[model samples]
Target: MIVTSFFSLFISQTVFAKNMYRWIDDKGRIHYSETVLPKDINYRRESLNKAASVKEVVEEAKTKEEQEMEKRLVRLRRDQEKIITRQKVYDNALLNTYHSKADLMMAIKSKMDAFETQNQVVEGNLIRLKQELEAQQKNAAEMDRNAQKVPKKLLDGIKSTQKQIQELHIAINEQKEKQSQIKREDEADIARFLFLTQSLTEKRKGTSIPSIKEANELGLFYCENDRQCNKAWEIARTFVEYYSTTPPDVYNDKLIMNRPPATDTDISLSLSKIPLTDDESQLFLDVHCRESSLGKDLCVSQKVKDIRATFIPYVNDALSRTAQ
Candidate 1:
């Protein structure tokens, strides 16, 4: 009887040899059998040898929703990669272009001075053209008073002077706009440079401060997750309202802003919430002044700098208190 039982066990093992299969059910239970049931055919399964080593694996079929989610994840990853690439390029340019913030400021001043000179020249021409137009008008009026018809040449001269004056006005406005654009671009560059250099310095020294001056200079606040970011957004909105001279213009989940500055003394503030990942976000604050010399000076003023510098700390303290 013992010999017969041993033979039967050996036969059973041989029969199950390469035909053994392992699979997981919908409830996540592991199952092993010599034959796969039709109901478990679509589930992920593995073929096993007599030694219980996996011989082959068959993947489970994905649902449409799962496939779509995978596609979205791929696209999101690609977009994130592109953003990282662009940021690297910007950082390299900032580091290579100027050695110091003062140097960058000087370059901006030089360019702005050139624009100012051009505008001055346009103003001079405009004044001369106005005088010429007045003279031509006087001649035409004198001719009319004497009951003489105004000469076609004189009329044409007045029209030409007026046109030149108009052109000069347009040119002056364009130059002012260009100067404003330059200031905005240059200030942004300076802020970026400060941030990069500060980071590099901290890395080299193997130390980090709780508050980064560069972050303050750039008017940026960072949050590690969505909950903190949402709370920070409200704080940023209040900060903008307290500082902005312009009235509110837009308010939304991703952006909060005030109208553009209407006067030289007016300051408009805007905040944008940028997502770095599902959990991480950045709040960026921007200050806008009028497109004039006074307005430009205001942007770089100590008062404005203080407002920016305090933003992150304000949010940090508020969030900490709430947690407590």
Candidate 2:
């Protein structure tokens, strides 16, 4: 059964090519077998292809099965080579971008500080805009409640103020999103910068990078090999699943979201403009109920332009917080 299973695997691997062995026997007869015989002598192995290398070889020497996989293996090597080349370029860029990793961290922090400051300013503007818009809306409502024809002057005032309010609201909303995006990117850069600098630091002292493949994957934020990163990604997935896909079992038309702590006051107006399904409405409400770093980031990231952005930022944030 074992031999049969072995042959089954072998055939699965080598069905594209057949091994040819040639030998001149004592009777002056040439004999060939697919499988190499024990204690075989005077047998010559055939070359399957011209483009064969040690990388293309399997188990010490190239075999017919190896030849069958040659083209496929070559394509895979090309793909891997591209990944390696891209990573090497990034390594060089990291080394050149700053005098040291500390310098990079300083720059990243400065950029993040700028984002936070900008968000604060936008928040203040939003507060003023909301107040102004409310006053204008109140005046218009009182005029209507008195059963008076809405005067052209008051109508114009309300329209102008409403337009300005919408513009400011969208501006602040967009800026908050940028803030979250920058934070996400900063975390990833910090992780990659530390990995690159540490590896290079050790290389200067004669030890090579721990494992080029591993460093490359980490540097790229390929979270498959990282448990914390994977968990963070799972958290992000749940947010996306709940918010973007899985709808609340029952849609609550009366359950209007009056903005969570993030204070998206314009969202009500904005939400009214867009045609949202019951599922999407439930999603918006459900998102307001959840509280997590990943959930907070999603609050900013989701927009009409990108209802389905990957949660890599959340993953990066999680990875950066994980210890050595």
Candidate 3:
């Protein structure tokens, strides 16, 4: 009987330990047992620990799978980020190499307009001067041919006209010098402008990538290479210096001609009347001849006749001093 009772007690304890309960006492201390606790005791179900619970085995497997999936997603995100960064770098390099070709063409057009307008101004002045010089020559020739036959008052008029002719010649030459000087300055400006534009074109044509070393050194945004950064700076500098003087918008407009104070009234008025044409060569020649003939100190008579013959309409009212 004693051995049987001992075996029964051992069996009961093993069963109790297998189905445990957890409770907290009024004092907040936790207790664990196999039997049901009193009603006053607040009981809670206990979660399994890795060392003591079978549920822990299943939970561990789920946790491991979740961790592996998270790792794969993180890797995929990192790879995608790398691809985006590389593509951005290449795009920036391409951007550094060019302005839009259309923009360059527009700039060229503006330059051409300015050139044409300036040349027109010069041509107009020349045409007017030619007309006046011819009239002066014709008057002087008439006076010389009929000197003895003229009255005393008319003789004085002939001498006065001759003096005016001499003065006109001096004025014409001075105008020529000023015009030549302006042309030289304008040429320089145009050359520098063209150089900057062509540089952009050449850079676009080449396939060279920006230098990484340069970009790292500069630490500037969009600077894939040193050359790009440098070129950008240069373009900015040119714009500030040149474009500021005559803004592109203003330069593109038809130029307003301002005649010099010393310009002959007849010549100035006549030139102002002639309209400009699109042909640059003819315009250039007209400008050169007009500005030059006015300033010529030698043979004003010959120049006056020559220019009058070239543009005959300018001298239609040759002797009219009012120039209308």
**Number of the top-ranking candidate, with TM-score as the measure:** 1
Q: How big is the positional error of residue 71 in model 3, measured in Å on the Cα after superposition?
A: 59
lDDT of 3 by residue, 262-312 (tens): 432122211111112221101111111224544443224554344433332
RMSD of each: 18.3, 22.7, 35.3
Candidate 1's residue-wise lDDT over 12-76, tens digit each? 46645357787889897777778887888889999877666678998887889999999999999
**lDDT, model 2:** 0.52
Q: Positional deviation of 189 in candidate 3, in angstroms?
A: 12
Least lDDT summed over 10 consecutive residues: which range in candidate 1? 202-211
Instruction: Give all TM-scores, in the order shown.
Output: 0.53, 0.44, 0.21
Arrange candidates, best TM-score first.
1, 2, 3
Candidate 3 lDDT trough over 10 residues, lowest sum: 279-288
lDDT of 1: 0.84
Q: 2 or 3, which is superior by lDDT?
A: 2
Model 1, residue 35: C-alpha shift (Å): 8.2
What does the lDDT read for residue 113 in candidate 2? 86
| Model 2, span 112-196: residue lDDT tens | 7887788788778778877877887788799899997778987888788778878888887887788789788777777787777
> lDDT of each structure?
0.84, 0.52, 0.42
